[model samples]
Target: MSLDSSQLSTAHSGKTDLVCYPTSHHILFWVNTVSYILPPIMTTNGNDRTTQWKTTIIVSTSLQNHDTSRMLLAQHHRIRFSDAVKSGSIVFPQSGIAFLIINPQELPENLEEAGLFDKIKKFVTVHRNSFLLLQAPFYGKKELDIMSVIQHRFLGSNLRVLPVRNNTEIVKGMLTIAKATSKPHVDSMRDRMSLARAHIIESSSVWEMLRDIKLG
Candidate 1:
């Protein structure tokens, strides 16, 4: 499917955060220009366990043939295509997060027109933890404008914006965020983070200096 750029506004914004929650309140780390937060590789039964798990994603039937869906399938994810979902959207029920993928070129010139905000409002209502995937070939003036509008409109809400350049980025970002924010995986990541923090404190000169001051 192709989008018309004329109706799109310009946009841009990305920041790194390191919150360690396993839900909507989680960290967003940047790597290879894609937003991802993979934990350190762990071993189980002498097998290296990365974040690749058999996760299920409920996708809109409208995107059943979309490239993003195909990419996710290629990665061995279980995808259930549903007509009941909002068009161009996918849901990771395990994480309680839903992603609406929209090409920047598809957005209306103004956020208020064509009930865009209302549609997004309903989306966020249904999926308490929602993310808007702004897909574009690259971040240009028009893309940045739309992103800015989306951010402003959803400010202070659970709706997060993930700007993706291609189907690969879209699938990668969604899976990264979804996996990081879901169940046992999240717990494991937290444990690893705690261990790392303790290691840092133990190895740091600042802590040693403080200890010396206390002893003196």
Candidate 2:
């Protein structure tokens, strides 16, 4: 799905802290480039200590490629990487707001697929605090259909799925997530509620559009 104006506009505001990208070598290049453009830190309690705030970018993939994935990301000093094995083992920070990128190719054929679903469920459970970002597959429509199903499941878990069409959209989505998660404690609840409502509306619209296209 293409990113709407609101999504694109957010990138310029420098709001997101943690962002995850696909494990592909091509995506790794862009993810590394984007990480250099760090978002501005919002002052907390009127303090000017900028060193306390940090943005972490992570690369995620399956365990079969864990060694290669780490090697690919090793050159990028600012980016961290992790892989989720079928055994439900995943390595990621325990706490903090994160923008998780889910490449359609890296996911199971469908969310209902047994063993893979369990692994995914465990991964999501561990990073329940994250904002999931679903990127369209580099392939075509069939892959997108599968991605849509995965997107819906994440939404059901109360996690917002930010859709992106391209690399630019990915950056924008990350910033948008950062902005939402970085709100003050007093405003955080309201922000989350608003975001949840938006996701519900957006997801419903996307599915409806998909059904219409399929029928047509």
Candidate 3:
């Protein structure tokens, strides 16, 4: 599902942020690069324990992509998405994540596909409580339209149709997705709400966000 690259446009600026890359908000966008994008999105777990976990997960369209994300996140510490979840190193989110950082674009022909897009859509719809952040390339118009359809059809809350138009938006989008992943990582009951709040984003943390996530 390689995008046509001519469909995305910046014409609509009524109230909502249509042109996200150039003039969306405070954050910057970067492409094909990762540094410190933003702190992982986290939730205060309802079932707080003695350890106080910080589950940093990297999600994408396919499990393979998720694997890709896992390798990328390993540079930070002794953390991997699969281990974080399997070993309970990274607990699941309080409200399950319907989906996050999904791209329909094909990775390779010989990957032994498992009906990727269909499966992703199914998971997102079934798990209604989980947050779904749909990542889409902002090349031009065609990709944007496809993204719009996916967002509208999905039965999830606030299906965020992210615009990875330029490096700034891509970086900012990664920051947002990583932060969302943190809810499962630092799964603590107390201060979960407070932690989720983006009040104190540090400089170093911001750079981490850049490196952890990717853009198409």
Which candidate comes out best when scored by lDDT? 1
Better of 2 and 3 by lDDT: 2
Query: Per-residue lDDT tens digits of candidate 2, residues 1-216?
Result: 343435533532433333323221011111213332222324566542223333444555443354323432443324554553223132223224445455665665545664544545666676656555555636477666865666666555735455556555554444334433443521543343334334443565655797789899
For model 2, give the 10-residue run with minimal summed lDDT: 23-32
Encode model 1's per-residue lDDT on 1-216: one tens digit a residue.
Answer: 111222111111232234322222235444224344444335576443424566889999999889888888887888999999888899999988899988878776776876777878889989998888888888999999888987898898888887777886676667666766788877766555444444444565766888889899
Cα lDDT computed for each candidate against the true fold: 0.70, 0.44, 0.35
Better of 1 and 3 by TM-score: 1
Question: What is the TM-score of candidate 1?
Answer: 0.71
lDDT agreement of model 1 with the native: 0.70
Tell me which of candidates 1 and 2 scores higher on TM-score.
1
* lDDT per residue as tens, model 3, 130-154: 3333344444455555566556665
Per-model TM-score on C-alpha atoms: 0.71, 0.41, 0.37
Clashing pairs in 2: 16-178
